[model samples]
Target: MQRDAARLLYGNAVAGIMISLLTSSFLVFAFSYPRVDPLKKMWWFGMFILLLFRFIDVIWWKIKLQNTEFDGKKSITHFVIGANITAIMWSIYLVYCTNQVNDVQLTTTIIAIAATAGGSATVLAAHKYTAMFYPCILLVPGSIGLLLSEEKSLHLLGILGLSFAFVMLLISRKSANFTVHTLFLKNENSVLIDSMEEKVKQRTQKIYELSNLDPLTRLYNRTAFLEQLKRVTTKSEKQFALLFIDLDGFKKINDSIGHKAGDDILRETANRLNQFTSNTQLVCRWGGDEFLVVFAETDEKRAVEKSNKLISLLSEPHTTENSILSVGATIGIALYPNHAKTEDRLIQLADMAMYYQKKQMRSAVCVFNEEMEELFAYDLHLKNGLTKAIENKELRLVFQPIISSQTLKVAAFEALLRWQLKGKDIPPDEFISIAEQYGLIHEIGAWVLNQACLEVKNWNTEQEVIVCVNVSVIQLQDDNFISIVESALSENLIPPELLHIEITESVFASDLVVITDQIKSLQAMGIQVSIDDFGTGYSSLSAMQDLAVNMVKIDRSFVNKIDSNGKAIISAVMHMSEALNFTVIAEGVETQEQSQALLNLGVHYFQGYHYSRPLEIKNIPAYLEENQNNT
Candidate 1:
């Protein structure tokens, strides 16, 4: 738009200059040829006017020069040459009209010679080779005719020279028009290229922003988080705290309210977290329902205080159509130079602390301490041990009898994983938590499934005993977990219905869209899924209704004190299971009284030391035989 306006203004200025020059030239020509024939005078005046119009073209050329944006030295040279050509034509027309040359008279000859010489000089200076060459040719012959004689042949030769000069001028004017058009095209192309370059720069910036930002919440993602973490860690004079926060019970909200509402809740939660933290703090979305906050130059106390404030802010009720959802957060903090020297280790320590905090019933923040470091070191050692366990054949599966209270007979065996490091045995709780922390549970879970299926394949009993294996939340997160289970069953020639996977409530405490799909996939393959450690860890009745689960294993926390606080809890869980048509398994029955109490509450499936402790694979055969003989 601006370019067009410039061109118009330049064209108008050139037209005005041409009009002024043409008017002045005609007045000179009329005054000088007052006694000449009227027709001849008019013809001369008309030619003068045409020459003035060509001079006015100088204004148009000037306007073009003003509008044309030149990029380099070459364009400036071309513009100067075009301007000099217009100036030469104007000079020649002015001299000719003022002199009023008549073909029959020799008095105007000198003026003609001077005008041609001047025009030739201008053309040579402007580097218009074609215009200069023809003018020089006409000038030599006309000068020869003036010097030779006042004869009729000289007049004829002079006429011939003028006619040839006029034809050359017409050709030069045409060439000038072509040059103007070429310059216009070149300028248009340059403008287009500039516009494209600007657009490319904007797109590049947008791509860079998208790469670092989370699409949903518009916060920095894990990639950007690590970059900032490195910057903070490299500065030796600065101290900071990294807080690893995980949303508590976010899975239940997603399962009950739907994913759309869950996304809204996540966005709102991010905004609230940002609001609670100061501008100096950096908050990033650390994948899924996890967030990382970097508090600069802060100690554990201030970090925990800020984390608690964020938690409190998030705990406010978010009103939705399905329900008024309230959420809590567990934060783990690791201080710089105190926790670890590297950014990766510090983040790991913070995550470990956060997991430990979430395990506590009432704690919202856990600071990295010596004990946590020891735990992480131990876990690191155990992870290395676990990786080699399969190669060394150090892992063994033992079956604990699940006794039916009504029949007083073993109905199924829950497969328990045990690992022996050298001569020492590792407890399932210790290594299992480590496995979950290191995301190695999926591989370990697959190994357990294969071992259990292999064992069941060799059993010679006619009675079908279900083999239950516990699965961690991390195990179910794998997309191929169900396929792995099916492959194991097929390889061992065991029926899918004979294998049951027991997942704790914590497994369901994640995005149920994934968990539900996994459960349905397993159930579709004819495998039973049960929620172990029920009545604990964010369990909701709606989850049981929506998930494809067959049983609920009541946690021992309620079973241990059934005579007092446990009775009401046991009754509620049993009743809820019964109402939902789910089989209830009472766990941690250590005494005969506890077993009898569970029986009175109509609990059937029993698994604890009351029957047998988690036995080694060697002792399992004898235990089963002994129990069978007694029955």
Candidate 2:
């Protein structure tokens, strides 16, 4: 920057010197024409010597300016000295040339002073003092020479010249000031343009970062992860693997506690994932409750080992403001060039493996395979069809009678869901698991409760027959599940005692406060609570103690055995049931021996194929009528 300024100064000064010298030479010759005075000659000669010396000094300075221009202090010092010398020399020339004060001589001196002073406006105006002094020096001496006039006309001309010199000085000051103002604005405008350019670059970079990052977890978003997958897959030699991680039971946690808890879980999960992942660039937030990771130049064995480590770490509890939350993860792995050549296909296979593993482990890590992929395709079809199954009348209720062992009569009927798609019956295990896996249980379970209540209302037996409908852990976690239950009872004009809700022990495996509160709410509405599939889940007796349960239904696994051990387990369960003052219903009494074994253990109620297979809603009327007369 300094170099450029110095260059401009050098060029302008040289040009001004040459122009001033040429114009003044013509004026000097014309004024000194005919015979010159001796005193005037000597004065002119002395002034010429000074002027010549100053001009040569400026020429030397200009030549050296090329080398010393960038030294800011030296360049400014040289310019100032050269400018001051020129001012002094011009003042001397004016004084000496106008000593006689002849009309022609006075005119010539005035013309020379004007021309010389005007040149400084362009060259030295940017330096305020230099421009101001140039005109002052030229005019001050000339006006003084005129002031010493003896003639009246000469005295008047002297006064006029003095006034004119004063006016010209004012003009020079303004020109210098205007030049300073122009320099200031040019500098400011250049700075402003540079600042705007920098700001634009910063904003553009920030926008790019936001587009590719997930706001909550601070991980890569779906779009960026896909781009990464494409980049990795394009390499033919280097192998990489894609991992899809899904947080299991996250929806239940979100619905039960709140979304804030879910968010905490997600952030903590991302942190944990980042710790296990050596490469930060490989982790991504694959939308809600799922993440995508890449292992560049990693083999399938190492991928599986890392996935297991991830699972173990994820299973550790995360403490939030309200609760200690812990959830499992399901990871699906697919290798590059091994699973598929294309990026989309690799991601698809990994995603399929993730869902497949989640279904089998109900949450764990597994690698992609042709079998798992094919099963996932079928499961995908089932999941998509399961949502619409209830609406399409593809699903219906089938009542399995639970009969009293001593009376040999129907005590209550458990409503089981049956799915028949396109004249082909889809097993409960297939469709129900699909529903639970994808959080459709809330929708499906509510429908079951509503349909059962309405169907039982149609029976109108007046015998206070109970209609038991199974509730899922997901359904129990739903905030609106209790409302749906109450609505079903009230809307159907059935007393809550005539309806029973059966929840498996898995529901107790969730938040105890939330689960117990829901069960208490159900019991408060006069609805009977039963822990179904007992002995098959974690515990049988202790959860019943927490719950306001009216009955405990033994899981079919325990009853179908009929071994001494099964009887012993049933005996302990019966004793516990009596102590708790709740009825015990033995499920899966498919043979006389299983029923007899249950009865000998002091169990009264039984349900299985031996008594009656699950009857469809339409066929229940005929069975109820036949049994109604007999009972």
Candidate 3:
């Protein structure tokens, strides 16, 4: 502040000194030559020398201002004070010299000196005290000369001069105050604008960071990952490894413990990847339970090895407060030069490989191969044709009988979907997932419900047998799903008791309250609810209990090749069902021994290829009669 004040008032003081010097020299040269009193001439010469001294002082101060750095208030105050004192002394000397001259000489000297003070008032007005003091000091020399005046007229002139100096001082002080205030407001506005700009800069930076980074793991998000992939593929000649990593069985973790535990598992997975990965690899969260790792400098072999190491690292048990979580990564690797040339193709190939491992449902890394691409192309073709296939009535269903062990007779039939496109049967495993992925499951599910309810109602004269339609999780969540099911039953004139809505236990992970309400509403309408592939999910007993389910169908995995542990698990499940008052239906009973074993465990229902393969709707009546005849 002091330095700025000094700089501001500098021009005024410099102008004051220059005016004094110029005027004094002019007065001495103009009036001293013709007929001068020796004493008066000497005094005028002394005044000229004093003005010259004042000019030198002003020049020296300006040089110092350029040469030396003016710092804080104290040094600037001292410097300004010295300049102001010199100005006052010049005014005092001019008055003393004028008092010794004749009236004409005095009149001219006072006018020149008063003009110098007048200029100072306008120039130095921004400094209030300095402006006020300047005119007062100038009036001192004239006022003193008036006090010792020999003539009354001279005295009145001196008094008038004093009054004029006082008025100039008041004007200078008011102008200085106004100028100082205006400058202060401009300075404050400048500071405020700068502060607001800085805040905006910081906020924009933070928003950018959040958009790029994942909150939980601080890895790049899907958008950032894709951008990085595009940059790498487009700009670099180097071949990179794109690894798509999916955590196997993440749904069970979420179903068993909850989403918070699931988040912890994901975080642990990310931390393990970060620790095990090489520095060149950029790890990112592709989406839920999925991560993408890009290796910038590596070959097929090194990439495989790196991916395998990452899988091993993730397999290490992560001990959480709830339970020990051990998740495995199914890695899919596609090399930049070898497998794909574009970013989308690279991610697609890697994702196809990852999904291949996901089908196996364990820790396995697969490299993109020519065969995989061929298979992906076929799957893509099926996906493209599915909507058309649905419209053309190419979708159909066949029923597999569930036999009662106690009665050795058909109890209920499970409706299985089939897509026959141009005389070729697309496997349910392939088309079903594709339907779920493409959000066509709701329509497919409604079709299945309509067909099965109508067919079963035709055969159900005694109203004893039920038809079960397998539902996808997506179908269950569909907004009009309940209406679809209700319309199927009302149109077919079928009792709800003869229609079972079968869902995998994975549905337990959905909003439990909502599922419970939905299930209760269906049950209230006389519909039977069952858990299909029961043991395949986490089987949160609470969810199973809350579902108010009537039956629990054991997954094929438990019954296909039952070991002692599998048998024990099956037995425990059977006992649990009995305790819970649920009927047990065993699936995949391929051999007589498997059926007998389930019968031994008190499971009363059996369904597998051993009894009968899924038959066409037209063949069901003949097959039922043939089975009755055999029995």
Candidate 4:
């Protein structure tokens, strides 16, 4: 809008100056003429007024040009040259109009020629196509009239000059219109380009944010965390801590509650973790229920303290729509430049430590140590051996008889796992721990459950002797474990009452609310659930009552030292089980003293090396037959 107005004012000034120059040239011609009449003087005065008006218009255009924002010196120079040419043209016109000359006829001819020459000169000086045509159309004809008719030349010059002036005015008008249209188009294009750039910038920013964030929890995802880990590790020489936390009982939560509720819990858990760490640490959703925390400039003690704080924070009751639930986390800490030199190694070491801690304590934090490296190496070796065990048929299920203490007869056999590496027996404790550590327990547990079910099907017993299999914490945590158990039962065509699933105290320690619900679901199918190594864990009396368990096996630690520390513990366990209406089984009985002590404590079942060691499926039939005949 502003640009169009400036162009209009400039064009008008050019037209006005052209009129003034023509009036001035006519006045010069009138002065050379001898006939100085009243009419001629009036004509001169009229030319003066036109020149004055032209000068006033020029001043007005100069003010407008001063106000206008010139793009460059080129536009300013163009306007100046056009204005100067128009001024010169107006002066020549005024000199011719005055009609004052020494020789009237000669002066009129000279003035006419001079006006034509001056107009041509003005057009050349202006260097404009529109101004060039004006001289040829108006000035050339007026100059030819001076050579021909004396009376008609002045009138002819006036008429022709006005026509040229109008032509110049029209050209200037068109130029102004074209200038306004061009500026409008350029401005619109500029705005469109700016808008596109802004949109691109916004989209790029959104993509960057999405790439770094976890979709489920809105926390920093694994990729982003690892990149940050690399940066922090590289810049700082000070030791930092990397904590790998895995939620205990998350699978049970998923199974008992729907996946939606489980996801809600996970998101809530992420929020809690973020709040707990705040700005002092970097908390990342490290896939599933696991999280990784990178603590800068922190040592082993501070890291452990932080882990404990986090554990304590998580242990608080979490409110869901269904119930008030409590969840626990097992944290594994690995120190920078101490436990590992690189970021990948550090994360791996931390994960290993966390799993080891989960296996040992089940719900406690553990730091990586040199001893852990040895244990990890041993576990790795066992994992390799176990992987090959299936191919070699070296992985075997051994049955240890759980005999009735009063009847002194076999009641049921607990299926224990044994691995033989090249005909040499590996202890159940050694390889079982390895299997759990390496996440191979699911496969091993399935093998044992299947073998035990098959063996139970083949057994010949008048009494309904049940086969119990110890399910690892890892196995219980598996979503497929229940399906595997159901399939095994169906494959063997054994009644659900004949099979019992034995879970250790540690399994209950993890996500107990979920574990109990899962156990109840299993119980609904008529399969028995027993707490193995019961007295060793921190199971509350209320929890024991709430859990739909059929039996509670007294831990060997309590059974072995029944006369000493075990006596009181075993007595308490038996009484507690009796009070809860749960059957009691005493494990690890090797001596008459231990046996007598448990019997006195009202232990109904006994399992030990004294009765029979865990045996192969082939050996179990003859042993059970012999024991039945002996009884």
Candidate 5:
């Protein structure tokens, strides 16, 4: 308030000086009407000197003090003193005119005093004391001088002058109150706007954190990593190496110990990476059990060295509350402007290299090469060809019979999808992974469901046999999967009890509550659910109990090694199946020895090439007839 008052006082100083000079000129001329007098001259000189000092003060304020942080109270005090003295000088001139000049001159002097006092009441209102006092000084003494004169007309004029001074004081008080109130409201509004801006900033920061950061590891997420990659590839002219790291056997450890211990391992991995990498290098938690690191300005040798160091760093045993867990990593390195120039291709090649290393040699580092590029291109070709596989009639279903171990009769058939493009066979793992990655699994899964239901309904077997179709995790999580099942069953007129939905045990790692609800809903609708590849995934026993699936198919990996302690693992699963009241089917029984061993261990069913390779729709009837004859 004081600053504003002082600024306003000086801001219009030139205008005020002009008005004062004009008023003083008029008074001097009026007082010196007949001849020049020393009194008028002295009054003119005093006014000129005061105006000169005020003009210089304003100039000095503009030059040195206008934008500074100097205290305004001192300036305000100086303004008040100068303003009051000027008013006093004008009052003395008014009194002199009243005593020495004629009635006309005195009236002119009174008019000038009234005008100046009224203008001051409004102009100086920023400071209440100055506004009220300056006008009073200009009006009070002149009015008293007129009232003390003997002239009757002068006495009436004096009374009116006093009344006008009182009115000006009231006007000054009201203007000053309004000015103070407006400034107070302005300050309050400023504070409110500032607070609102701060809150918006905080919320925006929170939103960024939620979107760009991984909540568990507090590392940059996939979205943030991709964004950074795009920026670096676009703006940077220098080369950088992109490292894709996958934690080897993390799922096995997670499943064996617990997810909590797995989470501790992941956090420790992230902490180690963050500590090991410098600011110039970027690190991110790309997804579950995988991380991405970018080394700025590097070559293949340096990248290999860094990759080895990272593998060693991550492979160290991590200590959780109840467990000391050890995990290893496989790193794939792809260089910018060396292998691929674009961000997508760079990340793709890097991931392919990492996958190659993981598949060939666990816990190692591999740099991308031309051979990997060719392999990636082949996969890409398969991915592109898969989109039209169904349209081209190149996609077909082959059913493998699940036989009863005791009766040696076909009990169920698992429908599997096959894609043959130009007579070149694409493995299920290759094409299925591509399908899931490119978001084409939903369409392909629905097609498989409908086709399997239609094909199984046409099977002319006397005994009713169930048809099991493998479902992807993506398909199960989809909101429309249940509806797809209903559509297939209703369209094909297949019995709901005869259709089995085979889900992998990895489903337990996902949204368990929702998946469990989905499983229960399927069971309620008379459709049985089976956990395919049972021992392969790290599904908890409690999750398995909660699912209460109808059947558990031992993964072929365990069956391939059935002679060497694989039976122990399968025996444990068999015991779990008996305790949980579910049946067990041993898959991939390519040898009679393995089959006999499994049957001796009390296995319920068998499905593998040892019985029959997956047969076509036309071949199924003959196989069943031949099997019935054998029975």
Candidate 6:
């Protein structure tokens, strides 16, 4: 505020000088009397010198002192002092003129002094002290000179002069107050605008960071990676390798442990990748458990070596506070200019190779090849066609019977899904994995459940029989999975007990508590829940006991070697089942020898090609009748 006042005072100094010169000239012209001539000359000299000094002060301040370093206090002091001196000079002239001149001349002098004093009120308003005193000094002496005269008219003019001075004083005070208030408000508004601008800049930077960075891992997101890749491709002369790394069985681990642990694992994965790679190389979380890396100026050998190292580093057990979790990585490498020219093509080829490696040879790395292109195309075709499979009636269910060891009679039919496309059979292993990867498992699984329920409901067997429908861990994890099951049962008019849900042991690798609750919910609906391929999964007999499952099917892998070293595992499973009060069914029972061995070991149920290959629903009646005759 002081700085502003000082600036205003100096800025209007020229105008004050001009007005003073004009007023002084008029006074000199009017008061050309012989006795006062010398006094007039003296006043003119004083006014000339004062005007020159004020002019010099304005030039000096404008050229040398008007800056950030300008001293507002010192500047204001000089202005106030100079202005008061000017006002005093005018007052002395007014007094001398009032005494020496006639009444008419005296009145003219009073009018000139009063006008100058009133004008100075606005000019000196920048400073309170200057505004109040400059006008008073100019007017008081002139009014006193008139009142001290012997004439009555001069005395009345003196009273009017004092009244004018008082009015000028009030105007100057008000002007000064208004100026200060306006300057204060201007300063405050300036500060607020500056503050708002700074905040907006910071917020914009933060938003940019968020848009480019992954929130969980603090790594560059997919959009940032693509932009960087495009820059590298356009600018760099050297070849770089893009590695697409996908964590294997991550979904299972994520499901088995809680998502919190899953998030921890992902963070740790990112940290490890960042530590392993140099600053020249870019590492980013591509999405989910997948991460991408750009190895600058790298070749096949180096890419393989680095990828294997990354795999080893990541495969180390991730020991959390509650559980020790481990996941593997399948990496695929595509070299710029070597594999493809465009950025999108490079990324797509890299992703395709990664999926090929993950699907073909897990925990290994593969480079882009022509074969992968064909396979990728085939996968694309399958992905597009799988949804339409049901509508076209290309998908069918074949049942493999689970036989009772005691009566050698059919116990249950494990419904197996088959996709026959264009007269060629696409294996369940291939199409099923494709469906799960493409997020079509939920739809397909629901259809299979409904179909299985309908099939079992149409059966006219004398012996109590049920149909087992295999469900994926992904499907089971769905919140709507239980409702889907209920709808299937209700729509088909099949009792829940006749439609057993056969979940793979891999389901245990997910949120067990939640899966357990879901299983209990199924059992509450009077539906039996069984663990399919039991020993092959990351679960034990103790887990089964806690699960309270109705049945446990020995995995085909264990049952395949039943006549050999597999007996001890089966015997242990049998003993555990007896103690835990759950039925054990040995799968992949190929020959009579395997069935007899399983029977001797107290296995009560069997399912495999040795009894009957999985048959279409039309062949099921004949097979059951043949099995009944044999029994």
**lDDT leader:** 5
Give the higher-TM-score candidate: 2 or 5: 2
**Residue runs of model 1 more than 4 Å from their true location after superposition:** 1-182, 185-189, 192-371, 453-466, 473-500, 507-529, 542-551, 573-582, 628-631
What stretches of model 5 exceed 4 Å from their correct place?
Answer: 1-64, 69-74, 86-236, 240-335, 339-372
lDDT of 2 by residue, 93-137 (tens): 667656544777677677667767766666776667777777777
Residues 399-496, candidate 5: write the lDDT tens digits.
99999999999998999998898998888988998898788999999999999999988989898989999999889888898999999999999989
The TM-score of candidate 3 is 0.73
Mind giving the per-residue lDDT tens digits that candidate 4 earns over 1-631?
Answer: 4444345445455554555456445544544434554545555566566566556655755775556675434443455455445444434444443343334543454445345434443333323443444444434444444434455645565555556555544554455456556667776787888899999999987787799889889888888988988888888888899999998867776766668877888988888888987856788998988999888888899889888999988777777867777678999999999988788999999988997897688678899988888888877877899987877899777788998999999888898777789778888888887777667777878888888898898887777789998888777766777799899999999999999999888865576776776798789889988998886756788888888588988888887677788788877877787788889898899988888878888899999988988887789778878887898
> What lDDT does the true structure give each of the candidates?
0.73, 0.78, 0.79, 0.74, 0.88, 0.87
Let me know the TM-score candidate 5 reaches against the reference structure: 0.63
Which tens-of-lDDT digit does each residue in 1-631 have in candidate 3? 4455555666455566566657756666666534545644565566656556656655765777644765536544654575576567657655765556567767777787677677767777656787777777877667767856777778777877788788878887888788778768876887899899999999997887789888888788888878888888889989889999888768666765788888888887888778777444678998898899988788999989888888888888877765887777799999997888888889899999987766665698898898887877887888888888768989888999999998778888899989898899889988988888777777778888998888887783332778898988778766687899899999999889888889888887666665777788789999888888888756877777778788899988989757667898898898888778888999988999998888888997999988989988888888777777777
Whichever of 3 and 4 has more TM-score, that candidate is 3
| Candidates in descending lDDT order | 5, 6, 3, 2, 4, 1
Which of 1 and 2 is the better model by TM-score? 2
Tell me the deviation in Å of residue 2 in model 3: 8.6
State residue 154's C-alpha deviation in candidate 6, in Å. 14
Give candidate 2's root-mean-square deviation (CA, Å). 6.7
State the local distance difference test value for candidate 4.
0.74
**Candidates 5 and 6, the one with greater TM-score:** 6
| Cα-lDDT of candidate 1 | 0.73
How big is the positional error of residue 118 in model 6, measured in Å on the Cα after superposition? 9.1
- Total clashes, candidate 4? 41
Can you write out model 1's per-residue Cα lDDT over 74-148, one digit (the tens) per residue? 433443344444444434443343334464343344344445444433233223353445354535445445435
